[model samples]
Target: MNSNQTEQGIRTLGVDIGGSGVKAIVLDEQGLTITERSRVKTPQPATPEAVLNAIASLASEQGEFERVAVGFPGVVQYGITKTAVNLDPQWENFNLGDALSKLLAKPVKVANDADIQGLGAIKGQGVELVLTLGTGFGSALFIDGKLVPNLEMGHHPFRKGETYEEQLGRAALNKIGVQKWNNRLQRAIANLEHLFNYNTLYLGGGEAKNINFQLPESVVVIPNISGLLGGIKLWQN
Candidate 1:
């Protein structure tokens, strides 16, 4: 592809990097998948270099693509990862976008995983919130389709001086039985509803299926694929 094609972003490789796995898919200009989604186990320790290698391996599996977009499970500011609570500590302050671009020989953009998932799931209407249940809790807020960016609500105190992630993350769920976890999630929903007053709440991530309680009418459970699908929006003007 030429510069114009690259600029237009004819084909985009979308990569979602999480604590447990890294998934990639090729999408056309319309943000529809054009290639089969591929996934690999996230390397143990998940250091920046190890994760980059995993992503690059997936990138090569997909056919020609003009550029790449990545959703990372942490705060990403201008492609620099500011946090990695679930991954190795070495990820902090790393320039993931530049690293991936150099590694893959393609332009790259990166954003917080939940933020990208919100980009894919939001309705672009009123205040919206997205909560991803996985190895850790991830959150994003949007108002009228404009992202608030890096809200990190998961790290905020929720109950008993514990952060939301500490109480709702996969580790927490496993520690507490399913019944207790479900109760906690219910309380969280009520609290979040009062706090954000969002018109919609989207629940996503691989663990979303574990939610056993009846969700409120305004809350919707989105497929895990939204994490990868939302990558296309990172390149949008």
Candidate 2:
């Protein structure tokens, strides 16, 4: 956490729901929030029951708040989840928004995990595209200040026997060398370029924070807070 971050407001609770764990943050209105909010490992089978239980647990630690925002590793339609690539395949039919709001007893909004990060990076930036190369490749698109969630373009076809994740994810980087990883990443970005034609790109995920190679001139390495910050925005929705 950055030093200046602690000096802000605390009316919001933001949670980033990932395949690994659920991270919670209690922030003031001015954005001052505790860094070590709360966290717990996510259930491997990520059934709706288990994921909601984890969220309730984290909220218990932060007490009450005006709203709650959760980042799901899948597609969401008015709060219903449609996927979680790394967790339970059952998440494909989750009513995450209603489930979480019931659990928290407050307004709740769930969005794609990658969009959470993208939100933090380009929340106020009218139009942008974000790609997160974490345990897997996650992506989100924004246009005219609105979020278009669950764009599973990561699963779109790429090089031989390779989906976008196979070529651009961290696991793939570990399997191949950085040089090859960059090659695949460049290709993957090319896909986004052709499909979305986005002028700006925000890159995140645990791995992208350390990208050393020269990326596209329009690409920006966003801080991880985009996920958390995006959660805050979702909470207000």
Candidate 3:
């Protein structure tokens, strides 16, 4: 047991369901990490059932917790998944919160993966935008700490009739090489700055580590860990 476990005696499990993997961590009431985050590769076909099973296995490693907060890679409204993105089309309209809660035997809170990430990364003031670069691009917009969920900015048309993800996602980076990919990111940043005029922009996700250029003062790149680290905040709302 750590200081948080001894002091507060309360903890919650934070789960991040990604396109490539699922990660979970135990966080005390004070928002301190209590366990080394556990991870499992997202199963083949990446259906709701498969991902839920994987998350359950990850949660089991943490023993027990009061509640579960999940950040899923799609549009989530009141625990229902509205979009699938990189996941199976079957995930659409799935009541993930109810299903996961039933499986884990605990209350569950579900939100857009990027929205959950922004909850951790934002300053809770002014206009903020978070972009997650991974198998696909995930985006969340916020103003004064309030989330504007399900923007799905990645699918919108961008350069040469390609969606932002087509030019900037992991597959794009692997296909175009880091230098060109980084250039694309720079341009994307410029475009977003013009479009949203956000006070701050946070870049996260597995591929954020690949950024090689200096970002503008308004831009910040957060660790990939923010994905799971931000999970606790889901219950705060």
Candidate 4:
């Protein structure tokens, strides 16, 4: 809709790369789309090269996009990953934005996967704490509209020699029954509330969608698929 964003065609597309898959969506200036979104398997090993190649291939199929944004599952420093938890060890110390940008030959932006999803869920709200319940727990703190990157709070010990992610994530959900699961969820929320004082807490990602029990007050459940729209905003900024 304006001069600056016209080059990327993301005025036409936004790509969300998750542990399981890569999602691509086309959007207008208002972040609304004129076409349907697309998704494909996220490469395993989830290494810098494999994921980058997958993104490049996906981008090629969609013709051309104005800009591309990827969500990495790790602690990101200046668009390069300083640490990767659930992904390939090779991902650690990788320059993802630069790598992907070179491959796509376009403007490419990367953020901790959950942060991008979190930003997508807040509908572009400047600041909020987002806890994404996926393969591992993804937590991101957005301060004054900037994503601070990896916060790995999931690995913090909670109980019984298990970390918070182990107690509350999907793997743990199946292992723990409803009563016990909600108990941990409650404690996790309490901890987050105390730590961040985030006015809004958005719970997104695949597992958040299957939440069966009642959520605590002020905790919002956002559609997991909705993150694609948020990815669009990354370039707009």
> Model 4: how far is 112 from its true place, Å?
1.0
Each prediction's TM-score against the native?
Answer: 0.95, 0.85, 0.96, 0.84
RMSD of 2: 3.3
Give the better candidate number (1 or 2) by lDDT: 1
Q: Under the 3 Å rule for N, CA and C atoms, how many clashes does model 1 have?
A: 0
Q: Which runs in model 3 stand beyond 4 Å of their true positions?
A: 4-7
Q: Which stretches of candidate 2 lie over 4 Å from their true place?
A: 1-10, 30-35, 123-126, 235-237
By lDDT, the better pick of 2 and 3 is: 3
* Candidate 3 lDDT over residue span 1-237, tens digit each: 655443466678999899898999988876678878899999989988899889888888987688988999988899999997788999999999999999998999998899888888899889999999998999999999988979999999989999999999888999999999999999999999999999999999999998889899999998887887787887766
lDDT of 1 at 34: 81
lDDT of 4: 0.74
Instruction: Please give the distance, in angstroms, between residue 228's alpha carbon in candidate 4 and its true position after superposition.
Output: 1.8
- How well is each residue in 42-149 modelled by candidate 2, as lDDT tens digits? 876777788788888888887657776777777778888887778887788788878777778787777888978876777455569988877778888888657786
Report the alpha-carbon TM-score of model 1 versus the true structure: 0.95
Tell me the spans in candidate 1 whose CA falls farther than 4 Å from its real position: 1-9
TM-score of 3: 0.96
Collision pairs in model 3: none
- Name the lDDT of candidate 2: 0.76
Best by TM-score: 3
Model 2: residue 151 alpha-carbon error in angstroms: 1.8
